[model samples]
Target: MLLKGKTAIVTGASRGIGKAIALGLAREGAQVVLAARSAVSREGGLEGSIQETAASVEALGGQALPVQCDVTQEESVQAMVQAALAAFGTVDILVNNAGVAFFYPITETPLKRWETVLRVNLTGAFLCARAVLPAMIARKKGSIINISSLAADERDAGTVPTGVAYGVAKAGLDRFTYGLAVEVGQFNIAVNGLKPKEPVDTEGMRFWTKPEERQGWVSADKMVKCALFLAAQDASGVTGTVSTDEELSLWHGL
Candidate 1:
């Protein structure tokens, strides 16, 4: 139980990589606060929902608090963080896994679409991190993991029809991780980024990628394990690094 007695707040935790990370933290003895926009409705392409994830966490002998939060909204993010603190005494970990992508050519990309993607993918992460940083600094012990994508490193010309917004936002997230890490290292707060080569198999992935072609993609469980390793003490000296599932498994023997 590497995270025994810890409390973790995982955004977009209803399913996919987020759900996997929440469950992984719970397995390590952390009380997980699962945050998502809506847990029950089938709208917005969200799969399984936060309530479902929370139930699974409880089934594993861990406590769970399902919180409704639209990460793009500052008030919603603040409420979610406050709710987590109310449910649990403090937050020891924050996983910024909530994101959105707009797959389109730059010329055809609508301003609203670009803004939505940026708000959810980058600004949302910023809001959540800002809301949690003060507490984490006060405790002087915390881990913040931002979920990014490999597309951030690749050139858009050769890849699928993904607009500049998604790529630029993810790249910004990576820079955010580095800047936050440097600023908070003295407070014993670790901030790092995780990038997946391909989409994990989830309802969201099915909608975003070719379902049959997702076999070669990294498993959500594998990513979750990597996230746990990052959240552990073994990564005490590691910060500002963007890691992958393969690299993490090799380094942590997962």
Candidate 2:
């Protein structure tokens, strides 16, 4: 059990990569907190609600908690962190996986759209990190993982740059991860970024990418496996790096 007896808070865990990460962490024996804007439902993109995720954890002999949080709001994030502490005593890991993407030409992109993307993807991450730092520093141990995208690296060929706001936000997130890692290394908190290839097979992936391109990307499970490894106590010394699912899997022989 890589995460036996630990507590993890995963944002955007209602579905897709976030949901996968939540389950993976729980499977590794961590007490997972499924934090999102709302409860998951059968009709929604998530496989189940936070309750369902928690149920799955209990079935696996682990513990789970469902938390409603709007990562963009400081008060909401603070409240979510408090709830996690109240439930599990402390948070040992934090996953910033909640994000939004938008497609538009730079010339025509609206300010509101850009701001919305930044708020959810970048600012939200910052708020969550801030909310968790005090507890983590007090314990002198923690891990923070930020989910990034390939768009931060390359624009799709001949496609009108699908994620201008997303890309900018993730780029900022990557830098934020690096900066946070440096600032908190002395406190034994590891911060890193994980970037998935384009055309990933997540629900959000399908919504963001074209059908023709879907088969070209990686699976959510692959990324979740990497997240699980990073959340382990064995990964304590690993920090300030960005990893791809394929890269991490090959390195770990998974």
Candidate 3:
């Protein structure tokens, strides 16, 4: 119950790592706000929904609020934050897990596709962080974890397919995490970036990649310990860095 009596907001929580993190926090006695754009399965076969994630949380005897949010839109982000505050009183943690990835070369990438990738992966994080900061600063305590990816340094990731725009956006997110951490540290709010050490076997990844290519991929649930550790941090503790799950696990001795 590391997070007992705490309230957390997890975006992109319809499925995959986001949903896994939501349940993990709930099991640790934290009330969770599950935010996602998808209320139901879409035509492209994207599965899971915030409603389903909330149901799972309640089944564990935890409090849950399901909100349909489009993080790329500022209004939607602000509304989601207000709903979380109204339901749980205040937010103790925020996991910015909403993202999109494109896996093609710059030459083949359309201008619209590149814009979309950057908007969701980068701008969406900015909007969500801005939406939550006022409350977190007022409380003088909070944790903000930006879910990053190895694509931030795509040059070294020879084993994984990388897209020019996706890499650029994640690289920007890394900077955002560090900058936000510095700005909010004075208010006792910890901000940091987290990425999978290995490719995650998420629903989206499974749909996007060939089955034979997922050999060394890890399950999304393996993220719990590190996420829990970061969620408990502040300026006096770890902050202002981008860490891989493996590194955090070793440092936390989880």
Best prediction by TM-score? 3
Instruction: Give Cα-based local distance difference scores for all models.
Output: 0.85, 0.82, 0.90
Per-residue lDDT of candidate 2, residues 185-213 (tens digit): 98989898987744556666566666776
Write candidate 3's Cα lDDT for 1-254 as tens digits: 89999999999999999999999999999999999999776777788999999999999999899999999888999999999999888999999998888888789999999999998889999998898889899999999999988888867645667887988999999999999998999999999999998888888787768878889988876577789889989888999989999988888787
Backbone Cα, N, C clashes tallied per candidate:
0, 0, 0
lDDT string for model 1 (69-163, tens) is 99999999999999998888788999999987877887888999999989998999999999998888888889999999877787745334456
Predict model 2's lDDT versus the native. Answer: 0.82
User: In model 3, what lDDT does residue 121 have?
Assistant: 86
Q: Candidate 1, which ten residues in sequence have the lowest lDDT sum?
A: 154-163
Order of candidate numbers by lDDT, starting with the best: 3, 1, 2
| lDDT assessment of candidate 3 | 0.90
Show where candidate 3 strays beyond 4 Å: none
Please give the TM-score that candidate 1 achieves against the real structure. Answer: 0.93
Residue pairs in collision within model 2: none
Ranking by TM-score: 3, 1, 2
